[model samples]
Target: MNETTLPPDDFHCGYVALIGAPNAGKSTLMNALLGAKISIVTAKPQTTRKRVLGFYTGDTHQIIFIDTPGLIRPKYILQQSMVTAAHSAIAEADAICVLIDGARALERGDLLPVGLLDLLRKAGSPVFAVITKSDLVADKKQLLPMMARLLEFYDFKAVIPISAPEGQGLDGLIDELRAVLPVGPQLYPEDMLSDAPERFFVSEIIREKIFEQYRQEVPYATEVFIAEFREEEKCDHIAAEIIVERESQKRILIGSGGDALKAIGIAARKDIEAFLGRKVFLELHVRVRDGWRDNEAWVRRLGY
Candidate 1:
């Protein structure tokens, strides 16, 4: 192995799970910390349905951040799997960061779900409370009460306020997390950002566009699968399938004269090319799977 791949003597490396409500900024924080977009982000809730691993390699430590799906009461097989993934990350992580939307907490006066608190209490690893979207809080003084409230519920290793968009309090968050990590060799190469394959991200990119392009149930009902990815001499060839639960949803996706599908394709192709750093020929096909979210077999087949 080369020098970059070899771990330093005092390197600290461990997994830190980021768990929170949907759209609470877990993916945003991970993307900011890694300086790359490994997890997809959208304005809609439950945008992330799987655990995304992002590697933040510093000279002294490599923090493997597990960006998990939002914590929720599952009503279907797919949601159950998503919650399971989040819980599994908590059990396996060296540390856990529970992110709460600062503005939303101020509005609702709730810091966390009772079940989530119970899970953290039982978790063997150290837990930290992170207040995301700090910039959205117009009155900075309100953060004090929110932080105090979180401390009353659990003995968080640290309570930090951060805004991923403005680059606020990120360095301090990193320092605190790094300090808690166990001293060991780097788990991944220094230059590596994530362990997930390229196809996963390519599919995610297409899914993100779907979420952005559609509203309400359409985005939630949709799932993208990359069936073919072949690297060519001058470009790459990719074929993807977009799965929906009903024919009406598929029709909505395709639109009149296939205009909507074409629009989604055009938008997704641009991002795919940018992410892959090569020209791409992306083909998308919509198919109805009939209540796949509630079917355990279909959920597993979709890699949920």
Candidate 2:
């Protein structure tokens, strides 16, 4: 009798890192690709400060998308950590997707993602390009020039143009991604969406509500921490501390007669309820942590 050799499995699995400049819609792209809001989104730049993984399973491939903070020049220690988180993801990813703002690139006549090609080259990961927020582009002809300029960035495998919110080019984006992934076993189960702790997103949801509540300097000065997250039979109880660097900002967060805090708590509680699929009783408080963003100790303590 002759010995028989078995063929290797053809199933694919890999990490895909989304890299871009501030507010370039990397989070939006990840949510769209997963068909779920695993990554938070906001108008504020650098809203994402950590690495979040969104897992997706298809017929033959399982892709783990790593949503990292938008890469930026770090003026503060917090921002340095944020940029570091994004860079770390790229180093571990098997494929790198460079997301660029189509509107901004068209307006400036410059493709901002070209700088990322150097990092991608250094990582030795196969890179592709995507022009995000395509729906915002009024003139169709404008995209041609933007896409043409991306050639200067590198000879990308495929440069896709996508509108994440409007459901355009998403399937094609997935197909493009599937081609670059490695043949391996799925790392996560099919039913799982993310690997982050519940408190991480609880803090993030509260942080999002803060951004929605304030403007200008307030958002930049604010961060949230979930001091206690407890579960009851009928409802979840969450207490979040809003951290600011100044007493004046703390007063601004609390509002006169505590009315502003009430509003923020109300909005955040509703979002948290929806997110957890349970009734939530949320508590909010404000504290002053001077220059927390510049202090690595507080930055790590605050869960960044």
Candidate 3:
């Protein structure tokens, strides 16, 4: 008797890295593409501190979108490392998406320090210049000059404008991505959305909550470390410590009667539960790291 076997999964897979300046909505774009909050988004510069991977699967394509930290000047060691991570993503990607906020234009003082055009030229990757926040800019006339100026930077393989918030031009962006993806086996399973482990997600969730609650430099000065994560059938309990520079900052983070900490915990737990699809018990604590952001050792230990 002859038996017929199923055909192999001939999926198109490739890595596409998103690079942009701070507050360029790269995280929002990634979340929108994945149809989930795979990466946290807030109305603050430098909200994302590490490289986040988001997966997009279609009938015949699996595009792994790497959401990197917004590029900026490196004032601290941590910031330098974050910038390095973004550049590494650019080098490793099968394709590159250079995201620019449409509402903002390059000015005399405003510049992308790494010389993105040159970097792209060196990497030799097919780059898509994506102007995000299309919904904000109403008049196309206002954007035309900006687009033209962008063209002067480099000859992009494709230039597309998208509103990640309103989900505009996403299909076209996806189609453009599909056209550029090399034919290969799937890099990740259809069900997987990120390359990070649960512990990393736990820390990020807590950090996101902290960013939402704090103002000024508090959020920027803060880092979340998952000291311990214990999983139970009933609940996945996480013990995380928020590292800060000074005792005053620590007090502020803790808040009166731990109200601020409670707020952060409550918010983080809710997001964590949604992310893991299970109950989450979150414990938060504040510690003084004495300018840990500039400390290379601390940055590595915190997994910058």
lDDT of 3 by residue, 40-133 (tens): 8899889988899999988888899999999887898999999998999999999999988887753332424367777888899889888888
Ranking by TM-score: 1, 2, 3
lDDT per model vs. reference: 0.92, 0.86, 0.85
Off by over 4 Å in 1: 1-9
Candidate 2, after superposition: displacement of residue 268 in Å?
0.7
Candidate 2 residue 141 C-alpha distance from true site, Å: 2.3
| Predicted candidate 2 versus true structure: per-residue lDDT over 106-193, tens digit per residue | 7776566445667787899888888999999988788987787787768788888999989899899888888889987777878899
Judging by lDDT, tell me the better candidate of 1 and 2: 1
Which candidate tops TM-score?
1
TM-score of decoy 3: 0.93
* Candidate 2 lDDT trough over 10 residues, lowest sum: 1-10
Give the per-residue lDDT of model 1 (tens digit) for 44-163. 889899999999998888899999999999999899999999999998999999999999999988789659987887787999999999999999998998898889999999999999
Clashing pairs in 1: none
Task: Identify the runs in model 3 with alpha carbons over 4 angstroms from their true place.
Answer: 1-10, 106-114
Compare candidates 2 and 3 on TM-score and give the better one: 2
